[model samples]
Target: MTTTSTPAPPRIALHRDRLLPAEPATRGIARELYAAVRDLPIVSPHGHVPAQWLADDVPFPDPTALLITPDHYLTRLLHARGVPLADLGVGVADPTSAQSRAAFRLLCRHWPVFRGTPVKLWLEQVLVEVLGVDLVPSDDTADDLYDAIAERVADRGFRPRALYDRFGIDVLATTDDPCDDLAHHAALRDDPGWHGRVVPTFRPDRYLEAGLPGWADRVDALGEAAGVDTGSLAGWVDAMERRRAHFAEHGAVSADHGHRDAVMAPLDAAEGERLYARARAGHATPAEAETLRRGLLFEMARMSADDGLVMTLHPGVSRDHHAPSRERLGTDIGADIPVAAEFTEALRPVLHAFGTHPRFRLVVFTIDETTFSRELAPLAGFYPSLYVGAPWWFLDAPDAMDRYRAAVTETAGFAKTSGFVDDTRAYLSIPARHDASRRADAAYLARLVADHRLTLDEAHETARDLVTTIPREAFRL
Candidate 1:
């Protein structure tokens, strides 16, 4: 059998009419506001795209792998609508039998399902504005779109580094395991041709608790990586310090934690040491696990203070909804569900210890919108070290973003909040997601200006800060 290369598709044009704002008065305001910050450099302070992709500079495989298979947002929604995961080449399904091209066609066929969805908006923006394909992707145009994208993937311009430059990214951060070698980051820092700033963010969920299935093995690996013994509590702390220093050497500016809830327990040194020993022995009870996790969190916060790494907490997730999937996929396969989170009371201990310190920075994220006005905004408003994180996970859409600003901005103001952070694993959607955020922010500001709440000039300045300045300052980029 023989396969031939496909030809490139014609460029898609984004006219001035496609811009948001339909009202005559607000339309001009929106356009002017967008113009002031549309081309500002993107500072992506938090994300999950690995640095290896940029360091090695490899071409992405295909539409199935790039778009359909890996994107939980795409597959999970499709699965919810009765489309089997196998059809999308997810799980342990056989890709050859599934027909990867047909999966792409099916996604395009069902593209209308995403109509008011953030996925649809991001896809349209990327298709029309970034990828330069004007035609709407549907059953009629699926094959053509797939072939065009595939052809581009084989081109040098579509490589990760090229896309990084074309996207106008000033700095990009990838989330990394505490036990990671970070060799790829070192390679990128040494390469002169690849000048784009790619950094790492420390994520220490695995090492902090022992309830996870493979904690013993993970601890041993951490010990080997950091040149410390894994048998003792003090040694484990030393190993963490070593790994943190390694991450810092590779340009890490922040540390990220995703806890079950915003709970913390302040334990004395002896108690913490005893709990750590029990956890390492795989004999930790539920209460012990919770206490140890919280204790390590406080330790992580203290380590951030000592090392100058900004601490970011993404709490309130109930991971692993499907036990079978958890057994098969391990974790983070779109099964995580959000629950109620308490910011004020749960974080009181940690906040009381470090909130007044000027050098300590803590960014708090939540899935509970109910906490925005009542708790989070108020907490961020008062604490010198606290900043509210951007609308996260399920809340990163246009409506949610606007609601966030409305809920918190009056009380906390713009400075108390961190700017947009695309916490996505899908690499291609980075520019699209950021573009949607920029437009949504501009639209919101336009409304404010039209309402006489803020002047057009002030809105323009605020737009620039939200897109560029705030993220840099908040994450220490």
Candidate 2:
């Protein structure tokens, strides 16, 4: 068979009214609302970007490394299409020039795989808006686009700190392990030349998971980091508290909890001590470890209530669904899948204790949309300390975001929602992700205005608050 490839577009253009309402009257309102918040400063409370990137201020290595490799959203979809993770530079520490170019070609050739996905939208924005690429991504234009992006990233203007400023980020929070010294965060804060606010979020998931391997050793490490003894359960709690204080001293505003579920029932002190002793001795049964893990989650919430760090909970993920893939490539290779989440009963224990506490603040996130209206909104509707987190993980797409707004807003309303969170490791896509969210919110709010549920002025104010005040209040930024 003889065939000719179609030529790529000369210039890729993004629509100005993208993600807005379809009807003319509603579209007009959405445009206005979107315009009001399109350029607002982003306040990212929860994300996976490393603080070292900003502290070091290094130029991105290459197009594939910067854009393709680090983004699991792109890689996972490509992997589903029978592409090896290595082809996309997933496990390569430093992919060679040839390898990089080859990976870029693979992405371009498979451009159709991303059609109608948020990954496509974010990549488009990153390429055209951020990196100044002209031609659409395709096999024919891969090398040209790669060269263009490479030239741009090589420029000093594209360094991490410079891009942070250009992205108009008011504050960016990075997730960090409990044992992390946060030296990079300290360096960024203490640097006289830097004025940007980059804070660390205390993520103690691994330490709290008593069921995992090396759980006992992780406890020792935490104790060593906190300069405390972990020979007893009291010392373990003391060590965690000390580390939390250390993070707070370095400008942490939130504590992140990611468990298999949202269960937070606390165990009595004697039972907790018994379980801790068994786990520390490597003799605790799986069931005992799980009970201890749930108790640890409650302890974390109790600590948050005492220390004033906003507690952010995102649960119900069956991480590393494919064991062989995890064994070969490692965790977070887009193998983590969401499971059904229950919040009402699961969170009743913690909510009962701290639901009315003045110092406690809780932001709940989920990948299960079923819980939005059925559980999350109703829960946040009553608890003064609770705020419904934005659509997260698998649900961060354009349509999912619109659905999220519709599902939660009826019960909890706009003020009770936690605004948008990018929750990304792809640093360059931050603005694009936030922009997409703003557009989705605008579309949803515009429909309300068109239906006379809200006035245009009220919608405008809501659009502004969604970008600014809501996140600030939710995360106590």
Assess every candidate by TM-score.
0.94, 0.98
**lDDT of each residue in 222-309, candidate 2, tens digit only:** 9999999997888999999999999999999999988889999899999999999999999999999999999989999999999999
- Model 1 ranges with Cα > 4 A deviation: 1-22, 92-94
**Model 2 TM:** 0.98
TM-score of decoy 1: 0.94
Residues 1-477, candidate 1: write the lDDT tens digits. Answer: 999978554344555634367898887888888778888887899998889999888898786777767778777787777777667777754576238898898887787678678887676767766666776777778888888888878889988999899899899999999878889998998898878899999998988767776787888899999998977777877888889999999899999999898876678889988987888788899888888888888888888878879999989989878888777655677778999998888989888888887678999998898899999999989998999999978999878988999999988999888999988888888888887788878888999999999987899889999987788889888
Best-matching candidate per TM-score:
2
User: Which pairs of residues collide in candidate 2?
Assistant: none
Worst 10 residues of 2 by lDDT: 6-15
